[model samples]
Target chain A: DQQVKQNSPSLSVQEGRISILNCDYTNSMFDYFLWYKKYPAEGPTFLISISSIKDKNEDGRFTVFLNKSAKHLSLHIVPSQPGDSAVYFCAGTNNNAGNMLTFGGGTRLMVKP
Target chain B: GAGVSQSPRYKVAKRGRDVALRCDSISGHVTLYWYRQTLGQGSEVLTYSQSDAQRDKSGRPSGRFSAERPERSVSTLKIQRTEQGDSAVYLCASSPPPDRELAYEQYFGPGTRLTVT
Candidate 1:
């Protein structure tokens, strides 16, 4: 069974608009959630992360909201730029599990200029 | 100043061949991890090593897969008798120990794409 899932295979947004990507996970033990962005032929880069203790975390134009009770999380990118186009992966892990992460299938985000 | 790196960015192998993929983690990082991403799938953890000792390997798909991190700086993922189903992009990541909160995030390599015929 997939512990983490990104139901949407892709998302598109016009530049300067808000882009929202959603993720759902079944593992209740997961306490740490993270987002990673990947460009073709490049490694994934850490984007942001949130601990279960908090409902939201933000970094500049990027914000991650977690609804632990719903086992759902969403990544919001405001004023999306063409440079933000990439594959976004949501990952989860139990802090006690020593950093081994379980990743979602990924959502391809395309920000049109 | 370098991030994790994997060698032979792309590899094509015939069936029954043995292949070894290498990863070089950033200096001083004490934890290394191996993961595989198949087409249309998420990256799955294959194994993890702390320092020079393997902490978990339960994710290795089968007996054909094995990994080693010697000297705590570099790691190798070896596949024996490769099969077509074994094709995937193998990714390596590393991070500092958990004691350093900000450094706990993993840095990934570009990944080695292995295609088995």
Candidate 2:
């Protein structure tokens, strides 16, 4: 069974627009959520994260919103640039479990110029 | 100053052969993890080590798989009698000590892609 899921397989957005990626989880024990961006052959690079305590967290052009009650979260990138195009993965972890993460399949985003 | 790194970026092994993958975590990082990512799938934990002590290894798939961290900074994942299903991208990541007040962000290495023929 998949504990975390990214329903959308791909997304596309034009430059200067906002791109939103959504994720959902079935495990209530997860208290921490993180986002990572991956290139073709490189490992994933950490992006922003949101603790269950807060509803939203933002860094520069990236923002993550968590809705614990709904077991859902979303990542928003404003003024999307072409460089932002890549595969995005959302992961959840229960710190007590040695911080092992359960990740969503991934969402590929294409930002057009 | 360097990020995590793995050796043998690509390996092709025949069925029933054994293969070993290596990982070098950043200096001073106390926690390391191994994960496997199959095509079109997210990563799954394989094992974890902290300060040279393995804290969790329940994610190991079977007896054919094992891992060791003789030192705090480097680790190895070995697969014996490899099978076609064992093919995947094996990733290694490292993190600083867990802190309740801070997020333990794991830095990953360019994974070693293992292909079983």
Candidate 3:
């Protein structure tokens, strides 16, 4: 079974607007969450991460919000640029399992300029 | 020299043939990982190594699939008697020591796409 789930397959936003991507998990043992952005034919790059102890973390124009009670998290990109158009994946770590990471399907974000 | 590098950007192999994919991690990185990504799906962890020692192999798909790292800097993933179902993009990543309080960030390579005919 999939422990991590990104229900949205795609999202669209206009330039200079806020783009939000959502993800959910079924495994309660996951204590750390991360976001990765990938371009076609390239490897995924780390974006931002948040610990279970905190509900939110921000870096520059990127922010991640985690709601432990609902087992849900989100990544927000403000002033979304054309260069920001790519697939975003949400991953979680199960510390009990030697930091094994589980990934979601991914969301393809398209920013219209 | 700066990021993870993988060899053979693309490979097409006939069924029952053996294939090897290579990964070179950044210098001084202690943790290495292998993952497989199928089309339209998320990546799945296949194995992990720390300083030339494999730490986890639970996600290995089958006996035909094996991995090794003779040194701390490079790793190889081998698939023997590859089947048609073995087609996927294999990814390699490296990271600093895993942190208990925070998730260790992994730097990934471009990946090698293997197509088993």
Identify the candidate with maximal DockQ. 1
Tens digits of per-residue lDDT for model 3, B2-116 = 8999999999999999999999998878777888988668999888767768533656557777788877899888889999888999999888765533336788999999999
Per-residue CA lDDT of model 2 for A37-106, tens digit only, reads: 9999999889989998999999999999999989999999998999999999999988788788788999
Selected candidate, larger TM-score, 1 vs 3: 1
lDDT of 2 at B44: 89
Among these predictions, the greatest lDDT belongs to 1
Candidate 1 vs candidate 3: which has greater DockQ? 1
DockQ of candidate 3 (2 decimals): 0.76
Q: How well docked is model 2, in DockQ terms?
A: 0.77
Q: For candidate 3, lDDT tens digit of each residue in A1-113?
A: 88899999999999999999999999989888899999999999999999899999999999999999999999999989999999999999866665657889899999999
lDDT of 1: 0.90
Please write out the lDDT profile of model 1 over residues A2-103, one tens digit for every residue: 999999999999999999999999999998899999999998999999999999999999999999999999999998999999999999987677678899
Docking class of 2: medium
lDDT of each: 0.90, 0.89, 0.88
Task: Report the Cα lDDT for residue B108, model 1.
Answer: 97
List RMSD in Å for every model shown.
Answer: 1.3, 1.4, 1.7
Residue A7 lDDT, candidate 1, scale 0-100: 97
Model 2 chain B lowest lDDT segment of ten: B52-61
After superposition, the stretches of candidate 1 with alpha carbons farther than 4 Å from their true spots are B54-56
